[model samples]
Target: MSRFRKLSQSIWHCQYHIVWVPKYRYKVLQGAIAVEVENCIRAFSEQQKCEVIELNVQIDHVHLLVMVPPKVSISDYVGTLKGRTAIRVFNRFRKLKEKPYWGNRFWTRGYCVDTVGLDAEMIQKYVKYQQKKEQVAEQRDLFNR
Candidate 1:
């Protein structure tokens, strides 16, 4: 095996950038709802023995940057994170109700995962920028209407 691959395999410190949107991009999450979601993320991180470096919760989507052990699969980690958060958020907040917070599934089927390198600032900025862009688009839509 390549030395780099061997070294990566030996030392498990992988930063994952994951994003999941609500089933229909509903504007159901607000205020305390966002806080609950953040809490859930932290809980999941603890459960998986991972560290959440940063998180950004928007009205319809969530962005998380976490450092996880190599044994954890990205798919499984994301599934658990999304599932746990959705359940906790819906349960704690009345606004979610039964219809909009989640359909058959809490999160969309797929998520984006990017592995971070020595310089993770770019990824952090990108995630932050995503939320800003969405806010801009939302404001534009409101004005247009």
Candidate 2:
């Protein structure tokens, strides 16, 4: 079921599907470390007042479906998540600090994000059709020239 949150001035439902991986895509996210990471994510989401719709922690990456308020910037929110989790995990697991690959970073500098909603497919189709329109526009310009 879809849910909407209400604020003093506005009611909204803003959701995003976010995916990110650790530095060097290491398969170290397993066993106790994975559990700790998952817990950290849940705690941080609560602190941000964001709802965790769904979460999947793979050996090398994490997939999260979250509902955040409109006031929150997705990039900033993602940065917070990555930064906090990294610090907590490293502190909790000292051995990780000694790993050459880990160095001084936990997550990579890049991440993938997409808005999620009922009209996602429709939006995708619309964007796909824009390419054809651009092609037609280019052709018309060539003919006119």
Candidate 3:
């Protein structure tokens, strides 16, 4: 399919590389929590008419490559994504909302966002490349065995 998306007024391809972590840089995301975060992000993207090109939820941080419409600002999108996902996660995992994570917050106050240009393919690769590398390593290990 074409990378560009069409609206009534414009045809555009705007991708962003966004990364954020839990409050205090905590590595609380894993297993079911990581899975839930991925689902929440996809749900959020769909709600905003955004496309998730790549998403990787790690123990400590999240990497997302998304094609966002021009009407939506990156900061606003990220803020909403963080806020909604935090609420969802915290609600589902009540124990997480207490103690170190005060104020019912899950993610940190800031996130890193960069616009993806013509090199979006490379950027997407970087977004979720760890899994490919690990799979290749596992294959090599199997061959050696």
Candidate that scores best on TM-score: 3
Worst 10 residues of 2 by lDDT: 122-131
Candidate 2 lands at a TM-score of 0.79
Which rank order by lDDT, best down to worst? Answer: 3, 2, 1
Instruction: Kindly list the per-residue Cα lDDT of model 1 for residues 37-139, writing each as its tens digit.
Output: 8888898899988888788888888888888877878888888888887778767764556565455465677887888886678888887788788879989
lDDT of each: 0.77, 0.85, 0.89
Candidate 1 has an lDDT of 0.77
Positional deviation of residue 57's Cα in model 1 after best superposition, in angstroms: 0.6
Clash pairs detected, candidate 3:
none
Model 3 scores a TM of 0.86
lDDT of 3 by residue, 1-145 (tens): 9878999999999989999999888878898899999999999999999999999997788999999999999998999999999988988888886676457678899999898998988988887786667668889999999
Kindly report which residue pairs in candidate 1 clash with one another. Answer: none
Roughly what TM-score does model 1 have, to 2 decimal places? 0.77
- Model 3 residue runs over 4 Å out of place are 131-145
